[model samples]
Target: MYETFYGLNGKPFSLSPDPNFYFASRGHQRVLSYLRYGIHQGEGFVVVTGEIGAGKTTLIKTLVNELSGDTDFVIGQIASTQLEASDLAESVALAFGVSNEGLSRSQIFNRLQGYLTQRRLEGKRALLIVDEAQNMPYSTLEELRMLTNHQVGDRQMLQACLVGQGELRARLQEKRMEQLRQRAVAFCHLGPMSQEETQGYIKHRLQRVGWKGRPELHQDALDSIYSETQGIPRRINTLADRIFLVAYLEEKEMVDRDLVTEVARELAEEQPSASDESEAALAGTQKMVSGQGEELMEQRLSAVEERMGSLEKLMDCRSLAKALIQSLQRT
Candidate 1:
C-alpha cells in the first residue's frame, strides 16, 4: 500500500519466509555452515533448533534454493502438523513420492526403501527436512529413525534433518528420545540478531527490494526497534513495516526517534493491559475451580461407560460362542 509513497519496488518487511529476503546474522551463518557440513557428511541426522521467528525456516529455505541445481541430490521438505506415527509415515512417503495411499505400514516402508534405493543407484542422495519438528510425536520420530535405517551396502540411503523451535532440543534431551539424539551428526541453534546486526538486517532487506533511502531512518529509531524486539528479525520486520506505513501516511522524509516512540507506544497499547491480563487469569482460575467438580464427575461417568462397553462386548462374544456350540450339537 505504501510502496509508491516510499518510492520502493515492493514491501521490504513482508512476514513471509522468502529466501530472497533472508539475512544471515552471525548465528545463522554458523547454522548454515552446520547444515552444509551435514549434507556433505551424508549419513546421519542434522538438527537445528531456534526460538519462534528466529528465521531457521528461512535459513533452510535459502540453503535449499542455493543447493537446487544438482541432479545428484533429492531434497524432500515437509512441515510437521501434530501427526501420528502412521500419518507421519504417510507424509514422508508422499513427500518422496512413494505412492503410499491406502497402503499398509510395511508396504509404505517398502515403497520408501525402493525410492531411496533408486535414488542412490542413480548416484543421488536423499534428504528429508522436517520443519516444526517439535510437534512430532515420539512414535513418529521413532518411525523417522527407522526410515533413516534404510541403507545400500553399508552406506545410508536416506538422510534426515529436523528443524524446530527451542523446545525441540528439550524434547530430544529426554531419555525416551536418546536413540534419535544419538544419531544426530550435526546440531545448531539459531539465536536473535545483535543490535548492530538488527540494524544491518533492516537495511539488507530494504536494499533487496530497490530501497533508495528516501525516508532516512535515524539511529535512535533503530535503537528503539532493537529495544522493543530484542533484536529478533521477524519482530523488527513487523514493527518497521508499521513505522514505514506511518511515515508514508504522514509524508515524512525522515524517521525520527519521536515517531518511533509514538509508534511503539501505539503498538504497546494494542497489547493487552496488565489489568486485563490479571482479570483474565482470575477468571481462568475461577472457572477451573468451578468446573473441577463437574469435570471429576464426568470422568467417573466416562469410566463407568467404558467399563460397561467392554462388559457388553464380552457378553456378546460369549453369547456368540455359546450359540455356535449349541448349533453344532444340534446338527
Candidate 2:
C-alpha cells in the first residue's frame, strides 16, 4: 500500500518469490552453482534442502531465470508431494505437455520417453524440478530414478532436481530409498544469514524496489527482525510488510525498535498455548443463540479457531487484528 505513497516501483516486502529481488548471498550462489552443474551434466538428481522459509523456491526461480533460453531447456516444475508410481507418471506426463488421458502408467512412461527423445533431438534439455519433495513416497522417487535411466551413452535423456526443506533430506536417509539417495550427484543446504548479512539483505530489498537511498528502518528494528525471523526471507517479508503498513498509517518516516517489539509481542501472544482453551472458556461463553441476533459471529469465530491448526497460523491472524485495534487506540 505504501509503494505509491513512498514512490517505489513495487512492494519491497512482497511475499511472492521474485527473482529480481534475489539477494545472492554466499550460500545462495553456491547452491545455484551446484544446481547448474547437475543440469549441465544431466545428473539424475540434485537435492537442495534448506530450513523452512530459507528461499528454496526462490532459488529455483532464480536458477530458471539465469539459465539462458539458448539452452532450450523444458523445465517441469512440480510443487506436489510424492505420489504413487502411477500418479507420479501422470503428473510428469502433464508437466511435459504429454496427453495422459486414457493412458495407463506404462503408456504414460512411453509418452514421456518420446517427449524427452524429441527434445534431445532438438539439442534441448528436459529437466524436472520437484518442490517440497520431502513428502514424496519412496515409491514415487523410485519412479523418478527409473526415468533418469533413459540415457544415450554418457548423457541422460532427462534430468531431475529435488528442492525441499530439511525434512526431505532427513527422509532421504531412510534405508528403503538408499538407491535414490546414492544417485544424487550434488546436494546443498542454505542456512540463516549472519547479522551483518541481515542488514545488507534489508537494504538490498529497499534498493531493488527502487528506493534511491536507505529508508531509515531503525537499527533495533533490524535486530528484532533478524532475531524474530531468524534471517529467513519469508518471515522477514511478513514482519516488514506489517511494519510497512504501520509506518504508513501512523505517518512515521522510520520503523523503530519499539514498534517492532510491540508487533512481535502481539505475534507471540497470538500463538495459542495449552492454556488458550481454558482462557477462552474462562473468559465466558456466550448464551447459546440459534436464529439471528449474535449466533453468526460466534459460529464464525469458532470455525476460524478450528481451522487454525498451527501456532504460526493463529499468531498471524492475531497480529493483524491487534495492529488494527492499536491503530484505533492511538486515534
Candidate 3:
C-alpha cells in the first residue's frame, strides 16, 4: 500500500521467499557452498538446519534458480508439516511427478527408482529436497535412506537434501537414524545475519524493488532495527515494512531512530493492552446496567468508528489490531 507513496516498484519486504530477492550473507554463503558440494558429488545427502524464518527456504529457492538452467540436473522440492511415513513417501512421489494414487509404498518406491534410473541414464542427476523435514517420521527418513541405495555403477542414481529447523539435527542423532547419519555427506546450520549484514540486507531488498531512497534510513534507525529484530531476516522485513507505512502516513522523507522506536512501541501495543481489557470489562458492565442495549451499542460503535477513522492514515500492525478488536467488540 505504501509502495506508490515511497516510489517503490513493488513490495520490497514481503514475507514470501523470493529467489530474485535472495541476500547472500556470510551464513548463507557457507550453506550455499555446502549445497554446491553435495550437488556436484551426486551422492550422499546434504542436511541444512536453521531456526524458524532463518531464510532456509529462500536459500533453497535461490539454489534451484541457479541450477535451473543446467540440463543435467533435476531438482524436486517438497515442503511438509508433521507428515506420516506413508504420507511422506506419497509426497516425494508426487513431487517427482510420479502418480502415487492408490499405490502401495513398494509400488511408489518402484516408480521413483525407475524415474531416477531413467534420468541417470539420460546423463542427468536428480536431487530431492525435503523442506520442514524435521516433521518427517523416523520410518519415512529410513525409507529415504533406503532410496539412496539406488546406484548406477559408481554413482548414486538419486541424491537427497534435507532442509529443516534445528530439531532435525537432534533427531538425526537418534539410534534409529544411525544409518541415515552415516550416509549424510555434509551438514550446515544457518544462523541469523550480523548487524552489518542486516543493514545491507534491508538495502538489498529495497534496491531489488527499485527503491531510490525517498525515505532515507539513519544509522541510529538501523541500529534500532537490528536491536529489535536481532538480525533475523523475517523480523527485519516485518518492522521495516511497518516503519515505511508510518513514514508515508506522516509525510516524512527521513526515518529517524525516534520514529523507529515509536513504531516499535505501537506494534507492541497491538496486543491486548491493559487499558483495552479494562474498557472491555467496562463495556460489559455498561451493557448489564443500562437496559437500553441498542443505545449503548450505538455509542460504543460510534466511538470505535471515530478511533478507527483517525487510524486510517497509518495502516500499520497496531492500527489493524485496534480495528480488529473494535470490530469484535461491535459484534
Name model 1 segments beyond 4 Å from true: 273-278, 284-331
lDDT of 3 at 32: 97
**How does each model score on TM-score?**
0.84, 0.80, 0.79
Q: lDDT tens digits, residues 1-331, model 3?
A: 7899989999999999998999989999999999999788888899999998899999999999889999889888888576766666577778878887888878887887788888898999999999999988888888778778879877798789999999999999999888989888988899999999999999999999999988998999999999988999888888999999999999999999999999988888887989999999999998777868777899999999999987875678688899999999999
Model 2: residues >4 Å from true position, as ranges?
213-215, 274-331
- Judge candidate 1 at residue 328 and give its lDDT: 100
The candidate, 1 or 2, that scores higher on TM-score is 1
lDDT of 1 by residue, 18-92 (tens): 999888789989999999998889988999999998898899998889778867789998999887887766788
What RMSD does model 3 have? 19.0
- What is residue 25's positional error in candidate 3, in angstroms? 1.0
Better of 1 and 3 by lDDT: 1
The collision pairs in model 3 are none
- Roughly what TM-score does model 2 have, to 2 decimal places? 0.80
- lDDT at residue 267 of model 1 (Cα atoms): 88
